[model samples]
Target chain A: MQDTVLIVGAGPAGLSAAAQVAGVGYKAVLVEKEDVLGGAPILSGYARLVPSGEWARDAIGRMVKRVEDDGNVTIHKGARVTQLNGEAGRFTAKLSNGKSVKAGAVVLATGFTHFDSVNKPEWGFGTFPDVVTTTQVEQMVTAGKIACPSDGRTPERVAILLCVGSRDRQIGREWCSKVCCTVSANLAMEIKELSPKTQVFIYYMDIRTFGLYEDRFYWKSQEEFRTKFVKARIAEVTAAPDGRLLLKGEDTLVKRPIVIPFDLVVHAVGMDPNMDNPEIAKVFGVGLEKHGFIERGEHYTNTCGTTRPGIYSCGAAYGPETIDDSISQGMAAGARAIADLHGLTRKAS
Target chain B: MAIHEKSLIEPERLLRHDNLVVDGVDVSGHWNTMITPRTITDYDDDFEAVIQRYPGAENVHRCWQCGSCTNSCTMYAQNVQFNPRYWIYAVRTGLKDEIIKDKDIIWQCVSCNKCTSICPKDVRPEGVMKALAHWLEDEGHMPKSPSRIFDEEFTEQIYARGRIEDSLVLLNFLKKTGQPLVPQWLRVFGVRLMQYLPVGLGMRFARNFFIPPRTRSWGRTGEVLRQYVREQKEATHG
Candidate 1:
């Protein structure tokens, strides 16, 4: 009877874990804090995903449907495991929806929160209506119109500044977000395709379209779509008297300061540790790393194993990760949880 | 692709003390040349538009300052100062003062077209170099160069006669540019060619030099072509 896996957060990681556990004929208890599934893809309304160019709703919707249709998976929407009791083999969890479930393993798939652009006031995110984040640009792309939010006019020139919230020593964020470069490149191509007349410029310190993404996003954007990449880190974004946004920065290649005017400016914001990492650590009786992510049990052998036994975690709960990577990690964590539980049952016999 | 410019410390900015002794040690001559630091505060905003007004420079605004053009440049390999990417950046950003500073070196582009072939943005940097040199001469920033005179002679031969007389074109180009009529290499090549000469081909070349070969059907085509070129120049410049 103690073969159930309690999975929290209905994101890509949690959904993948739920499907993996239920597919093997084991009971899975999936509890989500949100009313609907699919996590940030559906919540943030991402237009098209990086690397695949698939619509977020369509790609993540399939994962959500797979877990929901599984008979062995009992999902509690808008609920959380308020209290988790007992040890690895015999664990009892109390949900926020006034239901208690008995499980052998627990998986925390809590994802990240997008870095708010308002924190960098000089970038003029909140001060100007045309200064927006990459997420807002995605929303604008999904709406099929790229216009200035203030005047609702087609922009002649748009500038995307990379590493806004990530890799900024002033903000105390030392880690790279790992996806903004590719995301901004993909977004540049989409913008050029949608509005061919509009010139898009990406200001970057270093273009880290690492590995396979180099040719896919960076090269394709410049070669095919005519997107401009400038080696510059924009220092400030202010408005001109004519209502155009002026970007101040040195053209690092040419070695001179420039103040260029643009109709719109975008901040390629990064991902931060999930805000509930502190509370989730206390409730689950697990330790957190220095950056406030869930710490692993041991550096030698732990891939998904958390500080506490039988309490595994995956995806952005540990650090900033892509959806594809998080999904794979979820499957790995689920397999580890079930394997460890089966070993405990064998020992008891 | 990184250019370490010696022009950063200009000759005019250097103060040379020929016979100075500092602290009982003679730190004179080469060691005494001290460079005065300078700062720039302004740029000519319309300089990019002025360059684009010239032919082959219309796409200067499309440059993103990637160093690919400079990396693949033939002239850049010979002399690092002849960087198409840096000059294009200066043109786009309306840095006229900086461009004038490189006037002595800007015309050194050999027109190998390697930079154009490899440019991801299709900027056609080879054409841009030609246009920029013409702009420098036209704007009175620099005197007319020999390459511009050579281009004029070459184009003039094409318009006057339908076919090119290579020797005549070379003769006219050297005469107008005030260079020596026969350089050492050409003199050596001419002597070698005369020694191993085929009589029939040599006679044809000599005859062509006297009365250059003309395309038989070129009736009013040359006049019409000249008229069209004049109209284009007027339309663009005016």
Candidate 2:
């Protein structure tokens, strides 16, 4: 039997890793917990990808197609690796779907979970009908009409709040969820495009659009789209008697308090570690960081390699990362896994 | 390190020796303006705790100096010296003298509640402003401001009658503040109101001034509220 590589998760990272593994003459078995491929952005129906205003389906579809077309790749949908056993060059992953696979190396691409806004009661996520998450807003954007969920009327004013669950010491999450700033900026531009008359306000403590994304997404949203950037973290979101949402915050730049009314409010929620991280780590006999991400060998050089030899991890499973970076890390993990398997083959010979 | 608020320093305290040289350097220009430094030994360490005893200032400890309160303050827009964030900082640090410097204007807060609404830490800075203003009067740093006199007159009427006679409260407030019974603006407004007033309503309004209205069956309600207020004051202060 040809040597096989086992990959968990069918997200951007997993799909890229599977494509690389299969292209390199090894049979790849990809397991996905979800019934369909393409992770959160595709599943939730993302309107457009950041930095490039392309449809998410088209971009993620290309990666999904590459992995599916490769004859060396076998994809098992709605399946999960319940237990993993053995070390490098000889590992077994027992799947939930009454199946098992023996592989030369394993890659854990299990991604992140979007932060639930319910944790922040002050944002009025569940209490108010007009309040929605960025993912829900993505679905609304995909629907091609921006309206209040409460009244189904076109929203004249919309407020987008950034850093919902990230970099908040009160919530015990001090690490910045790097992609929220860019994602919120992109969503703001999308709202402005869909409803030209609708006023869009982004309330943020800081706008960190690292690298080229700053110019393409954040700055463009402000300069080109005329989106108002308020340097303030909103304290509360209360419902007005008129069924409109009230956003309370102080504009730090102006040094004044502002209580504005909006027809709809979108929370740019941050990424949280997957709930199953500890269980998955224990099953795979791998180490996890304090934040519960699958710890890598060395951050700089061996980013994809896990503490256990021949085991690898990439994408949001390692930490919060953009789709583009996740795919790049996926390929890196595939290359390292191939090299590890080849060294084992040479040793056997 | 001490926070030196330049505006707080008096112009008289700043000494500029135009013709003096030290260490063979001519430092006699604008650069030579020297501030007379004085050591502050009196700090009311219990100042913040005392302010917290008042209603609305319970969350003053949560302020992270994010400046949200001052940034959103209504008074700060009119006067740059009216900084709620800086005052809170002084209160938190027990810098009694620093806070007392702005005693005259602290009571000018309009209580618009914009600061309370926007405070990310739930500091309820509007309430803190009220608490601070009240503390200023209680500590004998300043006398009762016109706004405080108005609030007390209005609130006392409410507690006594379970409701308020607007004209009585306004007249009592004016009397307590030693202002004219009818100011220039009120005279103009009263003249304009008389044109729109119906004869019967105007007669009733005139009667209200002579005989102040009181709530019917306001038996022990007034006594109970007064007792509660007294008890609360004792509990908070002592």
Off by over 4 Å in 2: B1-238
Report iRMS values in order.
5.3, 17.5
Return the top candidate by TM-score. 1
Clashing residue pairs in candidate 2 (N, C-alpha, C atoms within 3 angstroms): A255-B71, A255-B72, A256-B71, A256-B72, A257-B72
Candidate 2, which CAPRI tier? incorrect
Per-residue lDDT tens digits of candidate 2, residues A1-349?
A: 2288899999989999999999889989999999889887777788888756788899999989998888999999999899888888889889999998999899999999888899999989999999999998888888998888887999987889999989888887777889988998888888888998886777888888999997788767865675666677888999788888888876564454667788899999888888889888888988998777788788686668888888899999987899889999999898888888887888889
Q: Write the per-residue lDDT of candidate 1 for residues A1-349, one digit (tens) a residue.
A: 4689999989999999999898887888899989999988788889999878999889999999998899999999998778889999888988889999999999999888899998999999999999999999899888888999999999988899999889887887777888899999999998988899887888998888888998899888866775767788887898899899989888787776778889999999998888888888888888998777788777457668999998999988888788888999899888888888888989999
Instruction: Give lDDT tens digits, candidate 1, residues B112-229.
Output: 8888898877788888898988888898988676787888888888898977899998888888877797688899999999888788897898999999988999999999999999
lDDT of each: 0.85, 0.84
Instruction: Return the top candidate by lDDT.
Output: 1
TM per candidate comes to 0.74, 0.61
